[model samples]
Target: MNGIIIGQFIPGDGFFYKVDPRSKIAGIFFLMIAVFLLKDIYQVLGALLLTFGLLIIGKISFIKVLKGLKPIFILLIFTFVFQILINRQGNILVDTNLNISLINIGLVIILFVIWRFLAKFKKFNFLLFLGFLFGSIFIFIYSSFSFDYNLTSFNLQIYEKGIEMSIFVVIRLLIIITLSTILTLTTKPTDLTQGLESLLSPLKKIGFNSEDFALIISISLRYIPTIFDEANKIMQAQASRGADFSEGKLKEKLKQVISLLIPMFIIAFMRSEELADAMESRNFVPGKARTRIHELNYSYRDVLVTAFTVVFFAVALLFRLNVLGY
Candidate 1:
């Protein structure tokens, strides 16, 4: 939770910060669509490279972006494994017959225990690589310990297409995540709200309230960090009261979680009430025309950036259609 970078803004003087928020928002939206439309590995790689280039230009920390991904690491792994397991269209990379035996089962259990222990260490990349290496070796070894007359027999088959598809999915997810992180990190909440309102202003002709939409977005973004901080404080307070959230059985953890959640809910409610009261006192009302302290203006640089983004999107679409020959 601490590693979450979404909805948090960092003050910086980078190119991304200088660009118009509307341009940044539109660029990221197009980029995200392009990422999902990508089919070839080379196309995905190009998108990733472009994302990295943006990160560099924005002067964002690569480590910080990776840390932001830690919260979804399990989801990414599950997607990878699920894709591989369910896909069976390509050439077989691994096809082995296995016999189930007491020794093999015990060895497998022991290997899992060792892996769990090692995973508790802080060397994430090293441990992941080691886990993959050892897991493959263990499967081979277990298959080799086959008995002529066994209680059960099994076959393991891994397909090349499955591996390729899983890689593509993982890369796609990473690119989208990186791009979103960049957007939130570089753009301020107020700027984002104004930009969104500007972009959606046409909706006013169709009986939609763009300012209300922008206000909702702004409030949501503004409250994310506040909620996180409140949750952290509540957690610490509970911990000081001898509540154990990190190490405990399922029931105990649930109780600890409830203790934390109750306080957070109360805090959030009170904060909302205060915000409403403040707005009311200032004569704030929904769907009312308001003047901004600062007006949004697009300079020549903004036009150039927007044009470049449109060209990039065009290229990506052509690549996806195979008209550009990858």
Candidate 2:
């Protein structure tokens, strides 16, 4: 939870920081579309490179971007592995007999021990986990060491296309994640609220309350870290009371989760109630006209960014349609 960076903002004086929030928001949307339109490996790689450049322009380090991705590292790996396992479009690359035996189990245990030993190095934890995952997988795939008694046996097949698709999917995910991280890192919550409100204002003709909707989004993003912190505190309190959430059976884990959720829901209600009271105390009203200290205005920089993003997205669309021919 602490690793999450989607809603968090960091103070910086960079190109993106100076750009209008509306422009940044719209640019990000366009770039996201561009990323999704990417079909070829080179095109995606090019997009990744552009994202890196944007990171530099935003004055955000690659390490910080990687940190933002730490929380979803496992999800990416699972996605990659799933794609590899389910894809059967190409010839088999690795076809081997995997066996479950005493030696194999011990080796896997040792690998886990090593991973735990290296857990203190927080910076490269994701890479370590990746290594552990692939290491265990390879151990099972090879099964080089085994006892006379075998517990189970199965054949593992890895297709060429699966590897290709997995890489593609993981890269696309990385690009999207990094792009979003860039946006949140550079854009302030209030600015994002205003930007979204402005962009969504057209919905007012349809009886939609853009202000309320924008406020909701802003509040949700603002509270993500708070809620995560609350969850951590709850987890720690539970741990102090002999609740082992990490090391537990499915039933025990579920019980622990319920215990955590009950308190979380209570806290959420309390927070909402407190927020409502505070707003009422300040004469806050929903669906009311409001004035801002800083009015949003588009400048030449915003125009340039919009144009560049539109062009980038257009090229990506063309590429996706095979009109560009790579």
Candidate 3:
């Protein structure tokens, strides 16, 4: 809501956007240190709280924010399920598969995800809908198994501490993933290039060319999203052709995926060729000087932000060393 569109750049004086890309970069680094350095549960919880605060201050809706977070939910659940039973350190709490461990972890993830997107709850109604969808699928599978007259059931036992730690780790990953996305969403690729160049400018004397490297890195950053969109389109077309992806057995499904992938690769190759021609037509040459239209002008705000990021990182490091945050 910082008056800047979520994925599109709007030229505005949002304090975060205006505080110099280099300082913003430093802030990200500081946040990483702060989040990872603290072993204290309270500290970790506080960090997430602070992250949400920053999210709000940036005027990004928690709904849109968690919409970004939702893509990684499968990974979160996978972590939960695996850690629930796989971790053998702590004492087992229950014998049933759907015991306290599973319930606790499932609830934690469900709650964290919900709270993480409270601003525009309606937008995340799809998640609730998807939850119902998966629940229905699971029921269908269970009924199918029961109709086969299989009386036995599989039960997984999990430890309590593992559940606790798993929740923490997954939540931490969420924060990191969300923040990383936020960085790219809020900052322009050109701004990011300058940030990287500035950060690595010190290495220029060591034969590291930041400008050229930054150019390629930004191009690569641009390439991933482009490739993803293209792949999605290809898949949609294949789906329309009745290319079944979900109904087959594992190997059969894999073959279906491969069939889809071959076209994707072919298209990617075509795209690369076209990109090469475009670059050639534009007289693209690496290791060359070019004037930038949007120049970086650091104000006092940028200086203060930089100093604060450095100081915050130092303090966080000291906390890790047990000199602070006790």
Model 3 RMSD in angstroms: 8.7
Q: For each candidate in turn, give its C-alpha RMSD to the true structure in angstroms.
A: 4.2, 4.9, 8.7
TM-score winner, 2 or 3: 2
True lDDT of residue 281, candidate 3: 92
Q: In model 2, which residue pairs have backbone atoms overlapping below 3 Å?
A: none
Misplaced by over 4 Å in model 1 are 1-6, 98-100, 124-133, 140-143, 146-151, 219-277
Work out the TM-score per prediction. Answer: 0.78, 0.78, 0.62
Instruction: In angstroms, give how far residue 155 of model 1 lies from its true place.
Output: 2.5
**Where's the lowest-lDDT run of ten residues in candidate 2?**
141-150
lDDT of each: 0.82, 0.87, 0.70
- Stronger candidate by lDDT (1 vs 2): 2
> What lDDT tens digits, residue by residue, belong to model 1 across residues 1-326?
55565566888888778888998899889878878777767788888888898888778999889987989988998898898888898799988776666666666677777777777776785576567557755764455443433567668678999998888899999999999898888888899889989989999999988888888887887788889988888888889989888998999999988998888888889999999999989999877789988677788768877786787789888887889882
Best by lDDT: 2
Candidate 2 ranges with C-alpha deviation above 4 Å: 1-6, 118-131, 145-147, 215-288
Q: For candidate 2, lDDT tens digit of each residue in 98-146?
A: 8877788888999999999999998788689879988998888776653
